[model samples]
Target chain A: SQQGEEDPQALSIQEGENATMNCSYKTSINNLQWYRQNSGRGLVHLILIRSNEREKHSGRLRVTLDTSKKSSSLLITASRAADTASYFCATDKNTGNQFYFGTGTSLTVIP
Target chain B: GAGVSQSPSNKVTEKGKDVELRCDPISGHTALYWYRQSLGQGLEFLIYFQGNSAPDKSGLPSDRFSAERTGGSVSTLTIQRTQQEDSAVYLCASRRPANTGELFFGEGSRLTVL
Candidate 1:
C-alpha cells in the first residue's frame, strides 16, 4: 500500500495563480520530499523537508510539515504553464531507508 | 554520465516471455532503487541496493521479479513469464545513502505485455 496519500487529485488553474497540494502519511518519517514528473518522463526532485523542520522554501516553492498530523503541503507561487505536471510526495520512514510515494496530484496550468 | 540512465526506453513483449530492464546510476552514487508505476497510479517500490549490503527485496511483487546490481553502480530488473499485469513504466533512482533525502530518477523503461 502507498504510505502517503495526496488530496485534490487534479487541479486546473491559469498561469500566475498559486497552487497548493496536500499529502498525508501513515507513519513516522525521517523526511519527506516532493517531485514533479512530465508526461511519461522521469521525476525531478523539487524540495525536501525534514521531520524536524516545520517549513521550507525554495525560490517559488514552499513546503510545510506537521508531524503531529502526519501531513504536509506544497505551495507554488506565481505558477507558470511549465509547472503543469504530476506532483508526488515521498516519505522515508524512520525505521527503514526506503521511501514510499503517494498517488500524486495532477496540475494543469492554462496559459 | 551525470544522471541516472535506463535502457530499452520502451519494450513490448508477449505474455509468458521474459524481459530485462537496465539502469545505470550516476557515478559514485551509493544507493540504487527500482520502482514500478502503472498508468495514473502511484509509484510502487520494487527493490533497493546500498553499497555492498544485502538488497531490500521486500517490495518485489512476486518471485518472478528479480533485480541485480553490479559494482554498486548498474542494475538490472528481470521479469520471468511476464503477464499483462506486469505492463508499466519501470523507474530507477540513485542517491547517496548518507543523504537519504533526494533521489535522482531515470527516464524509465515502459514495458507492455501483449
Candidate 2:
C-alpha cells in the first residue's frame, strides 16, 4: 500500500513561476525525500528532510515537513522549462527501512 | 565514477515467459533496492538488501517474483511466467548502508509483456 499521497495530480505553469506540490503520508516517518523524473527516465533525488527537521533547502528546491499534519511540501522557485517533470514524495517510516512513494504530481512549465 | 547501472534498458517478453533484470549499484554502497513503476504511477517497492543479511522481500507481488543480491554488489530480479500486468519499469537503487534514506536510481529497465 502507498503510504504517501501527492495532491494536484497535474499542474501547468509558466516558466519563471514558482511551483509547489504537497504530499501527505499516513504514519510517522524517519525522513521524507522528494525526487524528480523526466519523461522515460529514472528518478533523481532532490532533497531529503529528516523527521526532526521542519524544513530543508537545496539549490532551487525547498522542502518542508509537518509531522503533526503528516504532510510535506516541495517548492521549486524560479521554475524553468527543464524543471517540467513528475515529482514524487517518498517516506521512510521509523519502523521499517522500506520507503513508500506517493502517486506523484506532473508539472508542466511552458517556456 | 559510474552511477547505478541496469541492463537491457528495454525488454519485450511474451506472456508465460520468464525474464531476468539486472542491477549494478555504485561501488562501495551496501544497500540496494528494487522498485516497479507502472505508467503514470508512483514507484512500488519490491525488495531491499542490506549487506549480506537476509533481504526484505515483502513488497514482491507474487511467488513468481524473486530477487537476489550477490556479494553485496550486484542484484538480479527474476520473474517467472510473466503476465501482461507485470509490464512496468523496473528501477534499481543503492546507497551507503548508513544513508539508506537517500537512494541513487538507475535508468531503469522497461518491460513490455505481450
Candidate 3:
C-alpha cells in the first residue's frame, strides 16, 4: 500500500478564506500531484511538485513538498465556493507511472 | 480523443456477472492506467500499460480482475463474477512517455453490483 494519506478528511471554510490540506506518503517519489474532483466527475490535475523541489504554485493554488518529512500540503488562497471539491494527492513512486492516491480531503466553501 | 474517454458511464449488474469497462486514451499518449475508487474511499491502483504492454499488474486485487490494452490506444478492464465489493468507480488516465505532467483522466465508469 504505497497509498498516500491526506489529513483533515473534511474541511469547511467561507469564501475568501484559505483552505489547506496535507498529504503524507511512505516512499520516495519522482513527483507528487494534486487533483480536484467535482462530484461525479473525473479528476482535474491541479499541480505537480517534483521531489527535488520544495514548492510550486498555479493560480491560487500553492503546493509545498517536504521530502524529508515525506509529506506535502496544498493551500488554496482566497477560495471561492467554486473551489469546493475533493482534493487528492497522488505519488508517482511505483513502477510503470502508476500512482498511489491519498484518501483525499473533502473541501466545502460556503458562499 | 481530446482526453481520456471511458464507456458505459454507469452500470448496474447482478452479483456473479462479468463486466467490462473501456477506456480510450488521448491521442498518442503512451502510458495508460486504470484505477478504482470505492464510495468515499481513496483511489486504488489497479494496473498500467505502456505501449500495449502491462509491466505492472500488482495492484489487481484478485484473479477476477484483469486489464488489457490494444493498438496502444484503447484499454479494457474486465471484472469476472463481480461481488458487491467489486462495485466502484473505475477511472482511466493517460500520459506521454517520460512526461511528469498531469495525467489526463476519463470521467470513469460507475459500477453497482446488487
Candidate achieving the largest lDDT: 1
TM-score of chain A for each candidate?
0.97, 0.96, 0.97
Which is better, 1 or 2, measured by TM-score?
1
For A7-99, candidate 2 gives per-residue lDDT tens digits of 989999999999999999998888899999999999998988999899998998999999999999999999999999999999986754789
Which ten contiguous residues of candidate 2 chain B have the minimum total lDDT?
B94-103
- Candidate 3: give the clashing pairs: none
Q: Residue by residue across B8-77, what tens digits does model 2's lDDT show?
A: 8999999999999999999999989999999999999999998888999999999999999888898999
Off by over 4 Å in 2: none
Give the TM-score of chain B in candidate 3: 0.96
Model 3 residue A44 distance off true place after TM-score fit, in angstroms: 0.7
lDDT of candidate 3 over B1-114, digit per residue (tens):
688899999999999999999999999889888999999988998998887464489889999999888888889999999999999999999998778768889999999999
Q: Measured with DockQ on alpha carbons, how good is candidate 3? A: 0.77
Error of 2 at B70 (Å): 1.2
CAPRI quality level assigned to candidate 2 from its DockQ score: high
Model 2, residue A109: C-alpha shift (Å): 0.4
List-wise, what DockQ does each model earn?
0.85, 0.81, 0.77
For A16-89, candidate 3 gives per-residue lDDT tens digits of 99999999999989999999999999999999998889999999999999999999999999999999999999
